[model samples]
Target: MYYIGIDLGTSAVKLLLMREDGKIENVVSREYELSFPHPGYSEQNPEDWYRQTLDGLKALVSVVDPKEIGGISFGGQMHGLVALDEEDRVLRPAILWNDGRSIEEVRYLNEEVGKKVISGYTGNIAFAGFTAPKILWMKNNEPELFARIRKIMLPKDYLAYRLSGSFCTDYSDASGMLLLDVKNKCWSAEMLKLCGITEDMLPKLYESYETVGYLKPEIADSLSMRHDVVIAAGAGDNAAAAVGTGTVGRNKCNISLGTSGTIFITADSFCVDSNNALHAFAHADGHFHLMGCMLSAASCNKWWMDNILKTDRYAKEQTGIVRLGENHVYFLPYLMGERSPWNDPMARGAFIGMSLSTSRADMTQAVLEGVAFATRDMYEAAGSAGITPERTMICGGGARSPLWRKMISNILNISIDIPACEEGPGIGGAMLAMVADGKYSTVEEAAAAIVAVKSTCEPEPELVKKYEERYQSFRKLYPALKTVYGEL
Candidate 1:
């Protein structure tokens, strides 16, 4: 039998076709437009997602026998607000996870309502990117549209509903919404009341691998697929990526150095950081995990190489820096504000400690080291929660760089394992589909069978010491500039 995993990303929908034997058969991607009507706001049409996904699926399975496709699942961008009316029509463009227009709403929730109360209800403090803040933003700024909302869906759930005709979401995805009682694995009544929404307005929650429904008749016909294809309730992109990396069991870690960087630490039981620096959310494996996210990672490198430096010779540029962590210049990577330990959206990027002696290579190396140092901030937060990861599985676009991976391993003083297949969430989605189809008994079993390590990057003791000292200096730069960031 075959399974399909739809990775509904921010910029595009990636569809993967896999066999039950853990072999990927085909992959297709379809890009869509992202709209920025105002500053700090990001929006997308729900219809574009569905249309692109359908088209991508058509191409994904063009050469396969459609009747052999047993199941479908998804891994998608989390926390975008997708509102629907009573007639099931999209009420407005989705408010994306990257959108920072809800700063005031975030402040109100964190200050007025209190972080303790919010954290007690949802196991997380309010951030500008969270769904709860977006809902408040809509309610306050677009009252007419908010009043017409019949259902509130996350970005991926909207696609799931369109395909399966079932209004459902998985715990891993729902946890990011700030509307779910993450520790209890249910919708939080207090959060619902605060959002001015009822439980009925939310999708029925399921475990990420649980079967939600079958394909709708029309959808099945359009794709020339079997109507009985099981639809599994998939997970948030990060959680699904963790599954893909086999970072399922307790004490396991996965570091994603994508456009946004994250340190995901899986735990056997529920654990929240004392400072609420990390997100405590339910994992796709039916356990709990803490996550720390940095808003800019590879994107920072892209900005420097593409826009500022005016070159795509990334390897050429990186080759000039043989000094590793000994560079005197330091960079603070807060290009799009920041998340994780800081949670300060007002924070901005800066290149500190530069002098006339500083070379172009020094600044370039600083950008890469800056991201690695920031990743260490999250690593330390996980340590505070009593979870020390000796080694971590690395994924994402930035992970392709050997220098960056080495930097992360040495700076954090942990081994970095590269996955044989770095498809991340897309592959994890297919693995979940296989589980939902009973090809595997549990997510762990599927992960153990499917995930393979390609190589390992170990930290050298000497390099580790140097990076540790550099990290100490990098840490102070942010606090010293925090007050200045607020004024800016």
Candidate 2:
């Protein structure tokens, strides 16, 4: 039997077909538009997601017999507000996870409502990207549209509903919505009351690997698949990627270096940081995990190479940096402001310690080092919670760069395990489907059977020493500039 994993990303929908034995058969990606209606606002049309996903699914299974496909699941961008009307029609373009238009709502939730109360209710404080804030933004700015909303769904849950004709979401995804009582694995009534929404307006929640429903008849017919193909309630992108990397169970960690960077630490029980610096969410493996996210990661490298240097030869540019931890130049990877430990949207990217003698390589190296240092910021926060990850599994586009991996390993002074397959969320979605189909008894079992480590990057003692000194200085830069950031 085969399984399909649909990764509904911000820019595209990537479909992956895998055999029951953990072999990838085929992969297809379809791109879509991401709109910016105003500065700091990001939105996407839900219709484009479904249309592209259907097309990608057809392409993914073109060479295989559709009857062999046993199940389908999703790993998608989390926290986007997708509203539906009484007739099940899309009420408006989704307010995306990267959208920062809810400053006022976020402030209200954090200050007026109080972080302690919000954290007590949802295990997290308010961020501009969270779904609850977006809902508040809708109510305050778009009153008519808010009034028409009969249903509120996350980005990938919308896709799941379209395929299975079931309105459902998994706990791993729902945890990011700021409406879930993550410790209890249910929606918080207090949060619902705060948002002026009812439980009926929300979708039914399920565990990540639980089967939501079978494919709708029309959906099955259009895709030439079995009507009985099960649809599993999949997870948020990070949690799904964690499953893909076998970062399940307690004390395991995974570092993702995609457009956004994250330090995911899985724990056997619920735990929240004293400062609420990390997000406490339910894991796909039926446990809890704390996550610290950085808004910009590999995207910073992309911007420097493509937008600044005007070069497509990324590898060649990285090759020019000879110094490992000696560069004096430092970069703040807050191009899109920041999240995680510092929830400040006014934070701006900066290049300090530059002089006329500074070369292009020096600046480029700073960007990479800056991202690593920022990752350490999250890592230290995890340490504060008594969760110390001695080693971490690495994935994402940035992980493809050997130099960056080395920098991350040394700067954080932790070993890095490179997965044999770095498919991230797409393969993870398939693994969830595998579990739902009983190919494996649990997510942990499926991950243990499927995930393989190809290589490990160990921190060099001397390099670690150098990075330790540099990190101390890197830590000071943020605080010294905090006031300047606020003024800007």
Q: What is the C-alpha RMSD of each candidate to the true structure, in Å?
A: 0.9, 0.8
Best lDDT among the predictions, by candidate number: 2
Compared with the true structure, what per-residue lDDT tens digits does model 1 show for residues 1-488? 99998889878899989888889899999999999998777899999999999999999999799989999999999899999999999999999988889999999999999999999999999988899999999999999999999999998899889999889999999999999999899999999889898999999999999999999989899888888999999999999899989999889999998878999999999999889999999999999999999989899999999999999999899999899879999989998889888999888889998999999999999999999999999999988888898999999989999999999999999999999999888999999999999999999999989899999999999999999899999999999999999898
Q: Each candidate's TM vs. the true structure? A: 0.99, 0.99
At residue 269, candidate 2 shows an lDDT of 96
* Residue 103, candidate 2: alpha-carbon lDDT: 91
Which whole-number lDDT from 0 to 100 does residue 185 have in model 1? 93
Whole-model lDDT for model 1 versus the true structure?
0.93
> Between which residue pairs do clashes occur in model 1?
none
- Model 2 TM-score is 0.99
